[model samples]
Target: MCGIGGIWNRDQKTVDRSLLQSFTQVIAHRGPDDSGYYFDDDCGLGLGHRRLSIIDLSSAGHQPMASGDQKYWLVYNGEIYNYLELTAELVALGYQFRSHSDTEMILAAYQAWGYDCLNRFNGMFAFLLWDSSKQLLWAARDRFGVKPLYIWEQSPNFIAFASEIKQFTKLPNWKAQVNPQRCYDFLAYGMLDHTSETMFKDVWQLRGGQYLTLNSDRQDADFGKLTVKQWYSLPSNQQDLSMPEAKQQLQNLLKDSVKLRLRADVTVGSCLSGGLDSTSIVCLSDQLRQESANNIPFQTFSSCFDDLRYDERQYIKDVIAQTQVHPNFIFPNANELFEELDHLTWQQDEPFGSTSIFAQWCVFRQAGQSGVKVMLDGQGADELLAGYTKFYAALFANLFRKWHWGKLVNELITCRRYQNATEIQRMIEPLLPIWVRQPLRRLLGYASETAVPSWLNGSYLQTLGVTPQVSAKFALTTPTSIHQLSHLQITSTSVPMLLHWEDRNSMAHSVESRVPFLDYRLVEFAYSLDDTTKIRQGQTKAVLREAMRNIIPESIRTRQDKMGFVTPESQWIKHGLSDRFEIELQKAIASLGQWVQPDVLQKIFQATLDGNSGMQGVIWRVISFSRWLKVFDVKI
Candidate 1:
């Protein structure tokens, strides 16, 4: 994977070559190996690229690559795992290749199928393709947005696209202004990356499964004239398959996905958290390696903690023993996190939810240091399957709505026995009336759909016309089945933010991270199965567990507890880093200005430190936002 950027002056003004180069240089870390530029002065368009040299190490892989006829120029990021297969098909269709790179495959496929080529691609990508003949610019992101593409429209005449938001800061007339609505959603509801609108005003992202086409031919065109369309969507169709049939299909799909992602010139490893999702990947990868007789001990990276409450060393050991793979570990502490907080916030390009992101950053850093260029992670599995504990409530609600009283009671008993699910109130809350559920949720310290947080400046929010309501996009209603809930999480709520963090963290270290579970085929297949296949017998990712039954160790395969990667944020805020956290909190309050009530925020922090409130997430958001403002010099 690499970094890509482009500028198209719709008014036909000459494109700034140096400024385009600066845009490319800003994200140099994303692709440190090489850089290239393509300029079309006649059309007032420039495309810049930074190469990480993953698939093809030769200069032949160099990009801002062109078609055989040189009619189309493309600046692309991300690897097409199935490039070989597509290449064979394209060659059969008389398409010739100059390089053994996925980048060339994209051009050939597009030439053969036009926009329909997006449906055939099976990888993470965010790319800009300029059709010189049509004077048309086409941009698209992957089906799950594993890659990032941000758009900045300075005016109708000036439009730019980049792999990261920070690239826009280098523009000559650019000023950093905060998008208040996104900021409010972040501070109040912990919502981010859920919509195309970003934290920066007038900047938007090309979301997953979507593409944009901008025609310079339009005489009076503006951002409104840009045609953005959804090319992919989650499959809502369900299949009636038996447990055995579903298990076998899932196992095959996951294995094939892993095999495809393994097609890389550089060394590839995995991020193993010792949870079911990650361990299953490690074991499957190890199995694949053995099958191919590639006995070089597969490398794995992990984040460990000394604190037992936050540690997964035991589970990590279990996987290592089973797989016999070379393992690398990093111990991330509060002090280290604080020291790198500013740099981390800058790398993320926006405020993150918790310190768990730091743990992940540490993992990628260790991998980069270990010379692993590509790391396969288990991110999309949880969202695609009903892996979160909160999903249990949705499962229960679905059963109740269907009048499956016997099944619901059995599930409740089994869940309590195996998973130790004690949130009886939440599990049954979905069955209650809206009026009853809202107050109960508030009492549990969860934000109601319409209740504004007391810490937020209500008057300031009103002035900005920003409503402080939690997004119901992922909410569980009476009709919301587990599949529907999973779909929501995958599309709008959880997976988007997770993928955002994954992309930024991995790319920050110049490492390509792949998620096999996010393969569209695997996602569709998983969604097609019944909900029981996902979370049966109190087991989350039940189908995956059963699929890897004999392949992975039974201990890890049947694990009910889930902790992908965690940091001791609450503990640190209360004890070791309390002073530093307090200092940052004060600075954040000062930086935030009227956006937050200083007194209220301070009380919340104090209560959290005293172990009287569970507002560490809020405190972290405030601190993260403050650092972001300073790093980007954003105007509120």
Candidate 2:
């Protein structure tokens, strides 16, 4: 894993080495092991990298690594778990390698297969390859958006790309300016994955499963000349399979995915939350480890909280007992959440939606301190499998809308008995208008329907030319099958934001977090299966339970609650943070009047302090944005 950045001057002026070095140094936390730079003065092209040695510990793995012919150079970030396999295939094709590094495999693969090499990859990655021979640049992000890459077209003739947006700030003439539209979207609807646009105005992300190519020969700096393509997309057609067949296929695919992710040379551990997803990974990984000659205990990391509602210590202990794994726990409270707000926000590069992110931050920090370099996490499982209660409601609503009343009634009864029919109201939720739904959702502690918070300034939104409603790109859709909802959640909605948090939090501690659930094959297979296979007879992740039967602990396997890295934000606001929170909130209101109504914020603050948990979302969003504005010196 590494942090990579580069500059390609279309104007053909040599890039200043010091400027490149400075920009690369900005993300040193992403890669603390080694650093290198490559520049071609004549072509005005430069690439810099900071490496966190995982696959190869020797200098042989150093990047910006070059091809044997020196015609292509790669500054890469992320691991290709299947590199050893790809290496064998390349060697069969007469390709030679100087090192066991995946970086070398990438260079040789590109030499033999060109851009087609991307198809053969089965890992998380983002890379900028300088094709000196072709006078072009090729950039690609992994299929599932596991790794992040940000791009800024500084000028028509100059382009810069980095693993983190902070590096872009180091470039001369670059000012950290807030993108008002994204800010409006974030504050109003809590939407962050609606588009490629970032909170920073000019900087944009290279969307996952996508690639960009630039021709140095085209002297015109027109952004229009950039050719961006979606190299991979989810399978749209669902597959017809019986429960047994589906379970077998899923077991094989998921096991292979877990096996491949455990390919790193350094000690690799798992993040266990005692939840179904994390516990499943830990159990399966431990099972795999035991089968192999390596008999050492695998390390698992988790966050234990004082608040019982937010803690999963019992489940964590259950999994550890079953798997016989070493368990490490960190207790993060309101003090740590408030104390590390600024630095954590800085690491995230954008404002997170809630305090739960701090819980994850603490987990990763503990992993790094524990001398574990690579950690396996269960991030994308909820999206892939129909694990969220919201999905259950969505499936019911879709059935009712389609006049499948018999099925709907049967499922509703089952849900009430097994999973609680709490989400049944979501069946009629879409019929209500936004104005009514917004208040109703808030009253019920469900998600808010309106895009913007009630406390934001209406006039400011008008000036920004956006609305409180979610952007059309992100407007929620009611799908007929669990598979369809899974695709939408994974690609267009929730998983992207979660992936962003995982990348930033893990990288902040210089640790690599791999998600086995995101393995494309597993995601695709889950999407192809029927909704019944995923959420059957009121149980979420039913197919997963069936597949892991007798393997995962019964406590986690039978769990109905879904607390994903959860924190007690509402309680924290109501009790622990009244005094200091009011002080900071008042400062934010004073500094942020142009974007929010001070009177409304004050009311919300008072209501929250008065023990209204519904307003916690608003309080957290406002404070997070407020702190983000200050930490990044963001100009609105």
Q: Identify the leading candidate in terms of TM-score.
A: 1
Candidate number of the best lDDT: 1
Per-residue lDDT tens digits for candidate 2, residues 1-636, read 899999877676589999999999999999999999999776678999999999989999998999988989999999998999999999999998889999999988888898899989999999999888877889999997888888898886788989998888788788888888888777765668557899898889888899998777544454236788999999787888888999889988998999999998888998888888988889889889988867766899998888788899998888877876899988887876778999999999998888889999998999999999999999888888888877776677667668888987788778886553455676556546668776877777543544455577766678777654555346554565666678778987788899899999999999999999999888888888877788788888888988888989888898888787888878777788777788878877776768888887788788877875466777788888889989999887
The TM-score of candidate 2 is: 0.96
Backbone clash count for every predicted candidate, in the order shown = 0, 4
Global lDDT scores for all candidate models: 0.88, 0.84
> How far does residue 195 in candidate 2 sit from its true spot (Å)?
1.2
Please, what is the TM-score per model? 0.97, 0.96
Off by over 4 Å in 2: 218-224, 418-422, 431-452, 470-477
TM-score of 1: 0.97
Global CA lDDT computed for model 2: 0.84
